[model samples]
Target: MQRTAAPRQIAESLTELWSPRIIGELDDSYVKVAKVHGTLGWHSHDNEDELFFILKGQLRLEMAAETVTLSEGEMFVVPKGVQHNPVAEAECLILLIERKTTLHTGNVVTEHTRSLAEQLRSV
Candidate 1:
C-alpha cells in the first residue's frame, strides 16, 4: 500500500521539539516534519545537503558565514559540509528533506539528536 499524507497537517500535529518524524520517502531521501523551538546546535552534514521548508511560523538558520531567516511558506537549502544551527523563537512547524543516510545532527551530537531508527517510527 502507498501512504498518503499532508505535510503541513502532520507538521502541526507534532508536539515534540527538534524531533523529526518521517512522513514519506523519495528516491534516496526522506521527507520529515518537525515542531521546533529554540536551537538545534551547530552541525554539518559532511556528504548531504538538507532542505528546510517552513510549514508555519518562522526560522533562523545560523551558520559561520551568515544567517538566513525564513518565514512561513519559505524554504532554504543548507549545502553539504556547511555547519548550521536552526533556531525558532516560538513553536514552528517545518518540513525537512534529507538523504536517508543523513544524521539527525551532522558532526555534533547533543541531547536533541534523533537517531535514524527513532525518525523511522510511524508518525
Candidate 2:
C-alpha cells in the first residue's frame, strides 16, 4: 500500500484558493484535500454519502433544515439525496470522503462541477 504524510498538510501547502488534491483512494472510496473559502452552491449526490473532516480553520454546512459549523478536528456527514451548501468565511482546509463515482454537485451541474473530475487523481 502507498503511504504519505497526513492529508491535512497536503491542503495547507496548496497555493491555490479552491483546488483539491487526491491523497488516497480505496476501491469505491477516496480521500481528498481542498482549500475552501466563500460559499459553495447547494447540491446533493443521488448515489453517495459524503463526509467532511475539518483539518484546519472552520467550515459551515447549511441544509434546508439546519446549519452546522465545524471547527478544526471536527467532522460531519451529509447523507445522500440531501441538498446542502458548504461555506467558509476564511481559508480552511478540509478532507472529504466519498465514493469514486460521486459527482461533486449531483444533477445540479455548474461551473464548479466541471472542475470536480479534473481534481480527482490517483494517489
Candidate 3:
C-alpha cells in the first residue's frame, strides 16, 4: 500500500514555463498541476476527455466553434477527439484531470508533447 498527503506540490522546485506536477492519481485517473504561459498547440485526446480547472490567473480555450475564457475557480472539459488549444496571456496555474494513458496533446508530436512522458509521475 501507498500513502500521500492531500494538496501535493507538483511543480518542480526549479522549473519554469509549462511545468506540470502530479498531485494525485487513483485508479484510471490522475490530477496534475501546471504553470502555463503562451499558447498550446491545437490537439485532442482520441480516447479520453480532459477536464481543466483554473486555479489562478486566467486561460483562454479555443475550439473550432468558439473561444471561451476561464477565470480563477472556473473549469471546462474538452470532450474526446474535439480539437482545442489552451492559451494564457500571462502565467496561470491550472489543474487537469485525465486518464493515466491520455497524451497531453494527442498525436500532434510537437515539442509540447515531447515532454509529456516526463511530466507525469506517481503521487
State which candidate has the highest TM-score.
1
Question: Which pairs of residues collide in model 1?
Answer: none
Look at candidate 1 and tell me the lDDT of residue 78. Answer: 98
**Poorest 10 consecutive residues of model 3 by lDDT?**
5-14
List, residue by residue over 2-107, the lDDT tens digit for candidate 1.
7667888887787778999998889999999999999999999999999999999999999999999999999999999999999999989999999998999986
Give the per-residue lDDT of model 3 (tens digit) for 1-123: 665543324432315556566677778988788778998889989999999888788999999988989998899999898999999999887888989888877888766663555665442
Residue 74, candidate 3: C-alpha displacement in angstroms: 0.5
Model 3 deviation from native, Cα RMSD in Å: 2.7
Order of models, best TM-score first: 1, 2, 3
Global lDDT for candidate 1?
0.93
Q: How far is each candidate from the true structure, as Cα RMSD in Å?
A: 1.1, 1.9, 2.7
Candidate 2: residue 93 lDDT (0-100): 94
Give the worst 10-residue stretch by lDDT in candidate 1: 1-10
Specify the highest-lDDT model's number.
1
Relative to the unseen true structure, what is the C-alpha lDDT of residue 63 in candidate 2, on a scale of 0 to 100?
95
